[model samples]
Target: MAGILVVNERYFPDDELEPAQVGATSFSRSALRCLWNAGLSAGVILYKRAEELTEPQIDLTHRSGFRCATLRFNFDMGADTVSRAIAEAAARLCAAYGFSSRAMLYYQTDALLVFHPQELACCVTHHGPFVHDFVETFSARETAQAFGDAAKALHLFKHQELGVNSVRSNGRMFVLQHSQLQREYLISRGVDERRIRAIRPPIAPPTVSEPLRDERLRSFVEGAELLVFTAVARLDYFKNVELLVSGCVQARKQGVPLRILVVGDSAEDDVARQALRAHVPEELSAEFMAVGKLTKSQLYALFSLARSNGIFVCPSRYETLGITPLEAALSGVCTLMTDSEKVEARRFFPDAHRFLPSGDGLADAIGLAYASPSGVEQLGKELREAIATEISEENFERDTLSAWSYFSQSARQLDS
Candidate 1:
């Protein structure tokens, strides 16, 4: 019998599977580990959509450590619309893999948009900020319409063999939400409440770093009294990275010393980066530094350096579950984030600093901290202890198994 099939865009590259990869990659690895620990057969399908790639191929390395199968397929498709992209990719996958009915289909965020498989128990892990993205970027009416379209497009999955047309109406696969607010948002958007389950991901303890070795990082941290701020995220609008730059500009205008290091996949010539550079005044340009991707060791060094008089900011406008801020808190850095209701920042972290997603608001928050960092520093220690206690590895293991158990039970019923 086929075991669980994990489908995602990027299958944690073999060399980068360390705990430092603590976003979607970490969750993917954790899910696989959970399934493996449960003694169930499992495999992974790393699907990469391409326009010229000829055929699907199996990756030998993906199945190296785990005694499971792994297939690397390329789908010829355009990035026109997210839904269409997903549907086309799903079609290619179904054609290539002849997916069995008994196998549990677990889809990451990208595959969940429009690929609703018929029969064959499937589950979706919500990782992005769909509703929040719409509301923040568009209007409420647009958000509602977008949610309605998604619901209508992906909700119904037929169980033809079982003579059940209302599988979705009942509980078609489990919809694992990263947060209670996210699950509630899905329910509000007409998804069956029975099919939705909110399972906060298990966060591993932050990896400890050796003493700071990089001289450049050391200089950046100790060079100035500038309140060092570090942000890690994609250079996307919803990530609200521009706000961090805007905040730095605002702080500089107020004669406050501040320096920010943005670490992510931001290229020098990227549109967003270019726009930000042009917008910032020449005088304030030195206040911000955009470092593209860095190794895990480098990241740990930065986090360690920021432990004193520095803060990690996650100014994202929408988040299913903000992992970076939690990770920052774990690393003993004073973490500041947006006060997004959907993210429920306070619910998970009562002590971490928060601000509204605006240039002025972010600047004020940072300014206050810069003036009196004692409270922010104390908050970091509190947050570290809180995360270690609340998200203990033992608790995460138990929760992950419980989540799988619930889905497995639902899958069994479908086979019945």
Candidate 2:
């Protein structure tokens, strides 16, 4: 029996663990479940800040400043006893298991994955001639390099030279990209085309047999005459929740009766929330509801009500592939998303559904969506049909099985 060790920095839900039980699990859990269902003997390993190394774990791997900086960011320590303890624990585990320990996987939540490519590569290389696979759900340019470096290191360790197998690429995006650009990027990076798999992150399928629209939410949507913009993302720089609020305010000033709903927690930390409170006219503020995080059921119910009433807007500064828009599309709601040049929202939605350039442009797009409710309705119907055709259980099974086959082949190669 081969043991597959999955090193993740966060907790996963049970459904995302084994047996592949879908429907409402955390992101990490869903990924784990996906891996387990593929028939690999996998177990989870959580890496805490207290368990990181003080000095470099692998020789000539990471620079001293880089190592310290990584530790500081990940563990909140400049130099401490806890850091040493964590380092020892990781070293022991690596030494005991050796490079033959099935497959070593790493998944992280913070920006560390983006910054420390060389260190990660060194760690994997030090561990050895074992098969190494790197998986990241969210990563920026810096962290992506770390992932690339780890792949590169694995190739060098196994082949004894750096040529083609030195690195493998798997870039996760919220929106699918044109196949040509994706392929070109992979090839340019010297990644094995076979090794680079574009696995779109999965959302826990909604399970309510019937929609759960409460009277308050329904009434709220129904009463809103012009436009209703909504966003459900953490209060982070990239989310650009403020853009929606500001756009709504601008739309109202322009004589548009636009109402906005900014959902999810972290609103308290949002400077924009404060700015909106100060800038939005009292009448307009009433129209804009900043209801914090709601339960999944509550969110779905609200979505259903919104579909029956208004348009959904996702004004993210950067979304690898925005899922909310897809959810809105499925719920029979029209969406107006930002047109980040790199993103491929058009692949998923009609051109009319996207607005590029600025927040003012988003306001303009909202008006467009509102101007032709009948056309929006037609778009909604089309969206639902597309989702139904593309995201069925059969489709999930086919894609998932294909992914498993690829992983299985890699695992066998490692065993050999």
Candidate 3:
């Protein structure tokens, strides 16, 4: 029987792991769950901070019947050098344990740096590979200048060029695109049509059949003299949180009563936080609150506290079926998102539901949601229904099986 090696640079969730130490993104956590549920013997390899590693270790583990391997790395080296080290380390680990070519390697994101491109299948979960193309959607040149430098612009271009080349050279490239808009973007960027497989990231069932909206949360919002709009994501550049901050100022000037609560953080959070602080006007200083990262239970509690017209905005500049907006929708929070070609919000909702990652555009979307609260809430309800009907567990299972079958057959054909 063939097994799979799931490679993601960040930590993957092992239920046995402590909540405080679970560092996987919500999307990655869901994808890992879906893979395990599909009956694949998945061995997850992830990194640990230098401090988190007491010794070099590899362990065979199982979670709810799914067998996996945990390869913990000590992050004493810089990324560029460490990537090659991790790749060579992984190959040695596999060789020592007999993980073979019959066992396909799966990347959770467009991260091909850790392994030989021809030895694994990778998923493009964002538009980093096509940043130039995405930049055009939000007015690339001006946005770059607004973001503050030429080096950043050059990096975007370089990343796209190198990333596309990497994709083209890979054994297989999975584009997690749910719409024609997303699929076309990948094809235009040089991803081989034959090697591309479009799949939606799975949405796990909520921990509760019905979320208990904390009454104290409602009272606190009412007492604070603010209306809350919640967003959850790693504090990263592609999240376009700086633009969201600018738009909030614009919305407040327009007499819209709004404040933002940001959840999630990263080592890069300080950079993003500083940029947001610089954008905030003196009068609106307290209008934005970033609580940094939260536990999964805490996140669900926040979701439960969402009012009928409360909004959840995903200001990401790009995505591969961004799962946060869907989580918000499922939580019954009205959702507004950026016009990411791969975001499922665009796949399921009308154009009115999306905004560009520009100050004026995002302000307008928020103002509109504010203007017609009932309509916005109804739309959120419809989005939730659509997710349940269109992206069900059964659908996820079928898609998982289909992707596995394709890879398995292709591998056999090559061997024959």
**Best model number under TM-score:** 1
- Candidate 2 per-residue lDDT, tens place, 1-416, comes to 22223233232322222211111123334444454565432344344344454443322112211111122224343334433533443344344434333333333222122222221221111111111222232344522343345565454334422212334432211111112334444366464555544444354436562454456655666787754656554544445677777777777777776677766545345554565557567876678666555545566666666665577777765444555666667667777777764343345666777787476887787766666757556666666676655544344445544654555466455446
Q: Which regions of candidate 2 are displaced past 4 Å?
A: 1-26, 36-38, 51-188, 204-219, 253-255, 267-272, 344-346, 373-378, 392-397
Q: TM-score of every model? A: 0.76, 0.63, 0.71
Q: How close is candidate 1 to the true structure, as a TM-score?
A: 0.76
Task: Residues 1-416, candidate 1: write the lDDT tens digits.
Answer: 23354555444565552333335776666777766676654456555555455543444233436433333334332233433333333444444345433455566653432334444566667565554434555665544444455453233211121212222453646676667766665665566776666665666644667666657656767665655465554665456777887887887788777776677653353555566567678876666566554555566667776777677787776566777677677778777777877554446666337787788988887887777746556667776887677754566667766766677786677668
Whole-model alpha-carbon lDDT for candidate 2: 0.47
Select the stronger candidate by TM-score from 2 and 3: 3
> Candidate 1 has which clashing residue pairs, if any?
none
Ranking by lDDT: 1, 3, 2
The clash count for each model shown is: 0, 14, 0
In model 3, what lDDT does residue 163 have?
57
Best model number under lDDT:
1
Q: lDDT score, residue 197, model 3?
A: 60
